[model samples]
Each structure stands twice: as structure tokens, then as C-alpha cells.
Target: MKPRFPIPLLVPLLLSVALAADDDFSFDFITHGPMLGEVTDSTVKVWARSQRPGEYAVRYGTDPASLDQVSAPLKTTIEHDNTGWVTLTGLKPETTYHYQVYHDTLPTGPAGGFRTLPNAEEHREPEHNPRGLFNFSFQFGSCANQNPNHGIGPSLPTHATMRRTLPGKALFSIMNGDFIYEEHRTLPVTNWLSQVGLTPGESPEIVKLAPSVVGLWENYKTYLSRGVNLAAWQRNMPTVFTFDDHELVNDIRGAGTTGFRERRAVFRDIGIRAWEDYAGWACPRATSQGIHFGTAKLEEGSDILTDKDADFSKIDLAQAANLHVHWGTDSAGVDDIRLDAESPANPNAGVYDVLEVLDAHRLRVTPAAVADSTGSYSIGRRSHGKFTVSNCDFFLLDCKTHRQMHDPKEPGKKGLTLLGDRQKAWLLEEMEKSGADFFFVVSSVNFMIPHNGAGGHEFAEGKDEAWTSMLDERERLIDAFDALRKPVFILTADLHNSFAIKITDRVWEFASGPLNSVNHVPKNDEGDRPATGLFRSGPRTCDIRWSSYILPDLERLQRLYPYYCVAQINNVFNMPKELGGTRWVAYPNPQVIFQYFDGRTGAFQYAEAIGTERKP
Candidate 1:
């Protein structure tokens, strides 16, 4: 039996590479590695970060033995938090090549390799191609909590094992979101603060240290940098990213509690930046090349990406510093200018210009309207390009940023939406055009069950909390999707448990992982999904006590609800399967495994997967 390697998360100082880390800090592939971006036969983009400000570049070629070739140096500045991406151009089509990160023209890190995607015009005829059959499978799962959750017991071994050895093979993977848990606005949202090493006061040191309005981003930046799970995966398999609630401060809706849009604005900007800073380069099609990051168009009201819009050339440091709450004001000062401006009389529409002001410090904010003011756009400083795997193509959607809700009391309100106008249109447009053998839609939220809280039968999780909450919008998308009638598989993360829903033979949704958090139980069987962890089985409901650290999913449930049998994985990990070349996550044998569903319905056309598509 091989050992299951659980990645130890980083310390506070490490740029919380996961929310659990900071963004865009690839320095000569120091912490992570040649995370891939767009790929064509002749060109590809690679994203990496400098732990500190410095010069960076990549040396690549078709030959692993001789990678004497090098690209121009990408200088990372402290202003961009030392994150730099490099695009490698001039290469033959459909080829495998090696690359290494270099500092000052000296070898700085391990050499990584990638194969250029097949040309679009080239058909996958075995006679014409050496790459036989051209069949490839990518792995995906979510909800890996790096910080140990003391629920049921000190995090389940099943979840932890999955986190360390997900996809097991070196195939490409997508971390659909909730890669880390920020399930609370402040620290100590759960009772396991001491256990997780998080210090908690009304405002912890982290809280005290973050910028006033957008403090959460800084908080996540610290924690995400520490995520060893994501870092490890990125080092090897090219993992794509998107966000769910935990990436922010848990279920952060478009509307805030104080009736001010500032919370929404601040959280929105923070989430986007956090994604850009840490997860930006996961997909290059959206991040590295475009001036406009998201699917939403400027005319149809898409949210603007700050790094895309932030023009420091127009402002000075003094102004930049003043825009930040922590840098500009006292602890008890005004953190938000939106609340004051949005009032009928104040109508501070452009008084402070949050978008322009936030740009000063490299922070970003989009106006509720006016996403485009400066006419032309530029794709500056891209390292990689669109995310690609050989013979397979996928489109990742950012789910969380543009959710506008309706009054829950009135479910049928006409304009109630989950995916905003621009993004929804883009998804439909892409689906109609793509010709890949398989079509995959990725998100972080679970679209399987109704918007339930604590695993109960509550169909609505507040006003548009989960996708099901928005009645009209989800239905419309479902109708359009059903019409497409292709083999559309949705891969996603977000829930603690594992699930699947077959909307149609054309559409199959598979959800795997809580990774490092509380392994989920059959929904509605347990009392409630706890704030931090899950509840134990019946008779021992709501137990947050830690018995043993190593928990196999089978032992805890007695009867396997999803039946992730032990035959595939024993107590030890990394073992090879009897199938000679393949490996198993649990179950053994070729018996097609189809367990009974928990009878949940209407999750994205009776399938599963909540969603978020983070920028590359």
C-alpha cells in the first residue's frame, strides 16, 4: 500500500496561494510551476509568480534534452504583488516540450513540460495522427479545507486522501471552487478557531490588518497563499479555478445587509482581485489575453476587471494610498463611499469614482454601470493563453460575480437571475459553436439539490443563494441547454459531499470532494451542515468532537451512501490498480457503479454542480 500524502498548508507569511493563498505571485515558478494557459501549435502561455519583486522568464523548446531557448524576461514589480506570466511563442504544432523558470538568465526552478494542442483544422483521424483515438479525461472536485475542521472528528481521512491524490493520474483537473473556507465574514465563524490556528477577537489581527472596505481580500490573500493543496496540484497537473462562496466570506450575495451596495461592490471587487492575484492564470483565454476579463460585454453590463482597468499612469502614490481604508483612515473611519453616494440626494454617482480610485493602489472596482469609459483596451503582460488539454476543449464560467436576486417572497418575479445577462449569453453562444467531442461546464456551487441549508428540505437558500433559488433564470437556461442536446458534462465543486445527476443522456453532472473539510453525509439524514464541519451519523448528530484524524468515508457512514468502496483505496494510498494501467479512488472491479440518488431534484436540470469560472 502506498502512502496518502496530505499537503501541509503554508504559514501566514506564505501568500495564501489558495483563499487559503494570494494571486499572481509566480516567480520563476518558485512555489508553483508551469501552470498552463492558452495553447496552439506555435504558442503557449505559462503563469508563475515571484515571491518577491524580481525579473522572470521561461526557457522552452520541443526537445527536453536541449531547452537552450529562452523568452524575454518578465519583470514582476511589488506594485502587482510580484506576479508575472510569460507567453512562449514560435513552436511546431502538436508537440511536447520542456520549460524552466529563470531569474537573471540562470536556472531557478524545476523544468516542467507541456504538449501543444492539435491544430483546429486537423481532424483526429488515426491515419493522420500518431496520438491514437484522441480520448482524454480530466479530473475535478472541490471543497478541500486546508485548515483542519474539528467537526465529526478532525477532518475525514477520505476527504483528506482525495485532496492529496485527486485525479491520481497526471490528467488535467479543474478546482471548481471553495478551494478554501472563508465561511464567515469575521474570524471564529466556527468554534474550532484554536484548533485551526486562527486567532479570534471581535476583529482578529488579520481583520485589523486588512483594508477597510475590501479587508476580506487581504484576509484571503494571506490564507490562500498558505494553501499547499492547490500549490501541489498546480505544480503538476494543470488545474483550472473558479470561485464559490467560501472564496469570499461565504454566501456573499449581490445585496448587502445594510441596504448599501458597498458590501456587494467591495466583496465583488475583492473576489475578482483575489481570483486574479492567485487563480488568474489557471485559464489564459480569459485572463492573460483580454482587456475585458469576463463573458459580459461592455454594452450589456458586464463587471470590469480592475487589473484590466487600473491605470496607475493617471494617478500618484499619495492618491493611491488615500483610496485604501487601512492606508488612508483610522480603524473607525469611513470605509465605504458607496453608501453615502447612492442616496437619492447625495447621488454620489461619480463623486469618488470607486473604479478609478481603487485603481490607484492596484485595487479594482467597476461602476454599477459604465464598465467601459476608456474606449480601447490592451492585453498587457500575459504569460499563458487559453487552458487546453490535448484533444479536449472546455469553457469555464465565473458563476458568483454577477448574481442579481429577486425578492424571495415573490419567486416568479420576471428579472430574477442567477447568471447575469452578459455571461448567460456568452455560455449559450459558446455551446452553439463548439465542436469538441465533449462539452464540459465547470462551477463551484453544487447544482444537484435544492438550495438547502444544514442539509434540510429548505428549497430556497435565501434570495437566490444557490442556483435553484432563481426560478425563471434557471428554467430558461435549462430549456436552452436541453435544446442543444449534445454530450454536455458539467464538472464542479462547492459541496462537502459527492454527488451526480443525469439531466439528460446529453447532460451528466459529476461532483467530487470536500477534499480537506467535513466529508458530507446523505443530505437530510444528518441534522444540519455545521458552520465549519459536518455532523456525525444518527444518534451522534451535531458532534464536533475529534476522535481520530484518519477517517475513511466507509467507516463513518457504516453503509456507503455513494459507495466509494475501500477496494480502490485501502488505508494506504498511491497503490496501483489490478487493471494494470489504471488506478481506483475506491471501488474495484468493472461493475458499473450506480447507487441510489438521495431523491433530490432540479439541480441545473436535475443534474448537479454550482458554479464559478475564475479568470485565468
Candidate 2:
């Protein structure tokens, strides 16, 4: 029997890396992780961070005793905050492999192993069946902040529970979003005083101002080290992460027009860079290149471009920032500033790059002719992406980027965008082309449900952060799913409660976790269909299957408990043989069973099943 690893009460800093005096911040030598990611039939990426620059490698094999295979040594540099990944390849499909990390000659963390996904081709057979069915299971949830002041727990207990309960059964964990929330605003560091390890009432002047990059790095380091349970879970189970607002800043809308363009520009470049170092290296990227673009209104008749709040070309574009720009024509001229790579006038047309950073905010570009007036200036580049597993395609939508400010009155207008035109198109095309048995669309925010009653079930009013504000895009995506006639599971998070809503006969939406975030009371006004309980919430457009929030006295009932949804998928549904029958019959219909469990008591809170019926 495999020995059960004990959960540590306090998260120990990994090993010493670098040290700073002001905040007394330091990174461990083998800091935080030797976690797994990007696991496929024959490949898995092992990611780890170090306090110092050095070459690191991983030893692996099917047996824990022999552990014969060794990966090529990869170097960790201070440039990337001493983080990197070494991918192990030539692995056997559907086989389990054990691994141990090496800091040069010495082994680092505990031994860990994971089972590779089944080969896609293996599902087919000539004798028993021509088309084979793929089967697998995974657990998913989101919104975990290990900060005590946030009213969430000091550590992620749910991950420990998942690691304990699921064991070798779950293929990988899907961290839908909000992996870290400690990196709040940095213009002046709004929430710095409340951060852990800070002196009480530390003078704002004494606190070092961290650039978005450093700030994000510090948060990841702190969260990973402090997240003892999360650390324990990731060592064995790979996690696919997508970003929500908190990953960048609280309630960030990458493409929204309302925020300060300068800050958005800074966050995009820094945040993406930090995310790549910490999370993106292991995940598949969107075809759109994870590019996030937005337009800023230009000053009229003035050569200097300025919005109601910011000056164009003044947003800080970091070194190594890959950015493109398209200057728009007058509003009356109907500027063709759309992100059309085919249009010569469009910056994304691939002609001009951000020439040079004159300073922090000001930039220099060629064809100086137009430091002149314009309607709007569009700027964007590659950002976050998605991944897949087995015959299931996981389209983890880049919700943070490419979102536009929605007009509640004209919700269906072209201007209202959540998954920008490019991403939406990519999704539809991919879904249409995929031969997968199921499609799991992961959105960091609730898809069709509202968080508050302010907009009365449809719009969240001023908050463009949630899908409730992007009703038009929601409908369009739903239509696309309905057309496919496949089993589409829209798994969502960030609302801080678990919910299940049936959008159609073949499509459903499951909002999963808070993992460890503060409690957000579910409300009847959040949606149209209340599941006949205290905290039920679901869209009126469809029936709600179940809502964990609906339990009586929900707020006081289980406030500290974290939650998760484990989903099992199978290609066939079996009908037991009747009393006189000789054998059971198998239907090609793919079925998915979702089990929601509370972390505190390991109690089963709810379960729901859905499947695509095989045609007669």
C-alpha cells in the first residue's frame, strides 16, 4: 500500500533563493514546487523553482524502486525568477511513471508519479467495436486565496481533501482560476498593508514599490509556499490553470474600456509574463495566440492622444513586450480599427511594432506622421491559452483578455464582447472540427448566471467582469453548442458557490468552487430558476439541476468549508441485463457524473449526471 503523506500545518518556504531587506522577502532554494503539468499520452512537464541559478533535472520510471529514466537538465535563472520546466517524453500511454527532482547531484522533493492519458487510437478495435470510447475523470474548482485577512482560510484544505479522497483515480485537476489573489493593485499597493509577513502599520514610503512583475512573483511564491495542501496535491496531480480577474488584479477586464489604459497595458505585459513563468509553460495556447486587444478613445483634433483618464503611448510597455498598434480614423469616418490582420491599416496587420519606449509610458513608433489625432488606438498581443485531455477538449476560455465593456441596453451589439471575435471564432471552429466525445468549456467566471440581483438575472449592471453582462456572446456560444448536438459541459467558477444548470438537452453548466475563498451567499435573484431552496440560483432561460448554496442557513452552515466538483466521464452507458436476459447492453451515449463534496467533513453535498443519448 502507498503511504499516505501527512499534511503540514504550516507551509514551509521551499529553499533559499534570493533575499531582500526591505520586505525581508526570500525564495527557497528548491522553493515551492516540483509539480507536474501538461501531461499527455507520452509526455509530461515537470516544473519547479529554485532560490539560486542552477541546472536541474528529474529522474523517473514506472517503478519507484528503479526510477531509471532521467530528463535532460534544464537551467533555472534569476531572469525568470528561477522558475522553469523540464518535459519528460517517450512515456508509455496509459502507464504510470514515478519521478524525483534533482538539484544537480542531490534529490529534492518526495517521489511522485502520474498516469499518462490513454492513447487516442486505442479506443478503436476491429473485433469488439470499430469505434472505441474514451473514459477518464477529473476534479475542478477555483477561487483560492490563502490569505487570512481575506476571510478565506490560511491554507487550501479542499486540495488536501481532494488528494486524500481521489488518490490515483483523478487524471488531473483543473484550477479554473484565481490561483493567487495576494498581488493586488501596485500603483500604490492598495492591499499591501494587509498582506502576510508585513510589519503592522508599515509606512507606505518604506514599502518597496514592486513592478507588476515582481509583485506577481512574490504573490505566487508566497501562495505556493503557504498553500501546504495545494503544494501536496500538485506534486502528484497536474493542474491546468486559467486566469480570473484576481490573477491580474481584482476585477480586471483586459479589454474593457472603463479602466486606465496605462495600467491595463502594464498589467497585460507583466501579468502574462509572470503567468507564463509560473503556469503557462505547461498549457496549450489558444490559436489566437492568447492575444488580448482593446481600443482607447483618442482626443479630438489634438496631436496628443488622450482618453478621459489616460494618455495614449504613455502606458508602460515592458522590455520584451510584443505589442501592435492601429491608429483609428475620426469617429465620423467609422475607423476600421477592428483587429483585422488582413487590413493594411490595422496595427495587428503586422506592419508596425511599438518602436521604442521613450520612458515608462511614452512610446516611439515609425512613420512619425501621426503623433496626430484619431478616434481610437488599438493595442494588443499574445496572452493566455487553453489545453485538452484524452478525447475531451478543454477550451479554458481566456476570460480576462479580449473582453469589452458591454452596453446593458444594447447587450447584443457587436461592441459587447467577452471572448473576442478571434477567440469565439476559434472556439466554434475547434468545436466543429473536434472528434472528441465531449467538450468541457472552462470559464473562470459564471457563464449564464448573475452574481447579484442588481441587473435582475441578466445584466450585472456596471460590472462587465461577469458573463451576466455579456448576454449576447453567451447566446451566440449557446447556439453554437446546440448546433453541435454533443455533450457540452460548461464548467465555471469565481462566484464562490457550486451550481448546476441545464441549458439544453445536450448542454449544461456547472459552477464549481471557492476552493478556499470567502463565502459569497448565493441568491434567488441571481438567476431565474431557483432550485426550491434558500440559496438557489440559476438562469430563467433553463432549469437548475442543483445548487449547493440552496442548503438552509448556508452562510452560517458551512462557512469555512471549501468545495469541489469531481466529474467522471465514460463513453458508454450500460443497461443491466433483465431478469431473464443473458447479457447487459452497452449504448454509445457518453455519460458524465459530477459529484460535489464539501472539504470540511468530506461530505457528499450533491451529484448530477448527464449524457448524450445514442441515436436509434
- Please name the candidate that would achieve the greatest TM-score relative to the true structure: 2
Task: Please report how far candidate 2 places residue 286 from its true position, in Å.
Answer: 3.1
What are the per-residue Cα lDDT tens digits for candidate 1 across 1-616?
A: 6434334534432445353332333323454444665445577667665555677788887677788788877665433345567678877665677787877656765667766544433433333333322323344556555444312222334333433443432245566676555432333323323322334553332223332323333344444355543444454455567767666545555421112233332244334444565665556443222222111113214333344434555543221211111111222112232332332211211211234433432433344433343221111121112243442346676665455544656554577655656557767887777654345667565443343443332224333354545657755765676677555555555545555555544454556554455544433322233322334321222222111122234444332221111101011112244645422122121111212122111011122222211225
lDDT of 2 by residue, 141-232 (tens): 99887767444565677887887888767888888888887443332233433333234454332122123355677778777787788888
TM, every model: 0.57, 0.73
Note the Cα lDDT for every prediction shown: 0.44, 0.63
Worst 10 residues of 1 by lDDT: 563-572
True lDDT of residue 23, candidate 1 = 36
Clashing pairs in 2: 15-28, 15-29, 16-28, 16-29, 17-27, 17-51, 123-132, 290-383, 314-361
